[model samples]
Target: MEGAVISDEQVDLLLADTLEQYGYDFTGYSRASLKRRILRLFTLDKALSFAEFRYRINNDSSYFKRFVEQITVNVTEMFRDPMFFKTLREEVLPKLGTYPFIRVWVAGCSTGEEAYSIAIILKELNLLEKSLIYATDINPAVLDRAAQSIFALSYMKQYSENYILSGGTKEFSGYYTANYSLAKFNDDLKKKIIFSTHNLVSDRSFNEFQLILCRNVLIYFDRELQHKVFGLFDDSLEELGYLALGTKETINFSPFLKKYKRLGTEKIWRKIQK
Candidate 1:
């Protein structure tokens, strides 16, 4: 009981069971990452046995929800990788500004920090009135928190510094009001955002967007799944639209390589072909 180990076969069984019972397809995710997260959750929950863990995940809806949340990556912060945001502010958003109405999609948006960050940029650029930001994630629990527009007050200082590095001139604290332990962002920033549940593994693209940000999410996927997601993004992006990824991700060797042109050294690419 001290050092419980989940076998490879058991992992496969759990993955298959999850798909069949909950319609969530984790089959294409990287096995190592998935297994590690699953084991961590198993230990964190202190499950009596693997069988009990499996049973609870398969039968109890609430526990299944928690299982999905725990396994999927949710780590995010506003203005993460400040240089990336700086590029978005200086190079990307201006070009997008010419469009009459801009549609931005933040896939795997986690708790919506990225989406909120984009909204702040749009507002500052005087484009918020004509923009719509769709922020999506696989887990509804995170979406619920995201919709609240409230974040831990403690992280504000770091986020503020990131904002400054990202070329923000205004006081970052102006965006939110401190309420003891929590910081509630202004309603104006959340007005243009629509938070919803979207599973990149199984969900089809719902709209064509001028800009799509799926940072730090693709690394957890296998090559095949990454290809599938690239195809989904291609279909969902408008002509000449931009796709941004995490610092560690790229479009190299993918079938869509010839279709996109990299933007400088940043992990952003613009679609140049149909």
Candidate 2:
């Protein structure tokens, strides 16, 4: 099945139907990215026609769940971008530790790897007891897996290397117990973390935070949508709070740019003005 089989009109129709019926808005998502994922799902599911694909997504609740999961990108790993975590450990977390209670929002935290990574940092810094991490994603299926505190054991070697590169001094294996093919992370690492569903497209800011990490998420949104989400993050972040983005993302063109000061060469910016 060629990707061209799914026409632009068909993609638009599917997005509209998804938003109307499920309240999951992908309308602001990058058309090329969305179309690509939709086409992939269409092929993988072996749908005979666009009509069958649309019908399954709209009428079957289970299929709709699968559609949401498939469309939304969920690729993530612990301590992704080691230097980012290294900066957090050496600079960001220290400043945040001064606060009586630290509140961190890991938006678009797919399957919880990054959330756990943050928890590990807080724990090592002795700030875990004083901190709360809200890990959220638009897809509930991923959120469910995140809440389980389990990840593929096969990825540990890479994750452990990332941890070491990120200035971790302890044995990375101490963080989780291997159970056959899966590794169950320590329950303590999740004690201060909360996993929930949040749609950046339509959800309102639920709380103000000292740090908000929405890395690699906005790249999937159109410029207009990216600005809207930046506004959402702006409203949810307290004065002097920090916002982190993926290496490919930046706030240079955002209306909020002047209000923030970039931190070093990393894609982190500290809010300098309320």
The whole-model C-alpha lDDT of candidate 2 against the native structure comes to 0.95
The clash count for each model shown is: 0, 0
Candidate 2, backbone clash total: 0
Q: Please state the error at residue 224 of candidate 1 in Å.
A: 0.2
lDDT of all predictions: 0.95, 0.95
lDDT for each residue of candidate 2 in 208-270, tens digit (9 for 90 to 100): 999999999999999999999999999999999999999899999989999999999899999
TM-score of 1: 0.99
Error of 2 at 46 (Å): 1.1
Residues 72-171, candidate 1: write the lDDT tens digits. Answer: 9999999999999999999999999999999999999999999999999898889999999999999999999999999999999999999999999999
Query: Model 1 clash pairs?
Result: none
lDDT of 1: 0.95
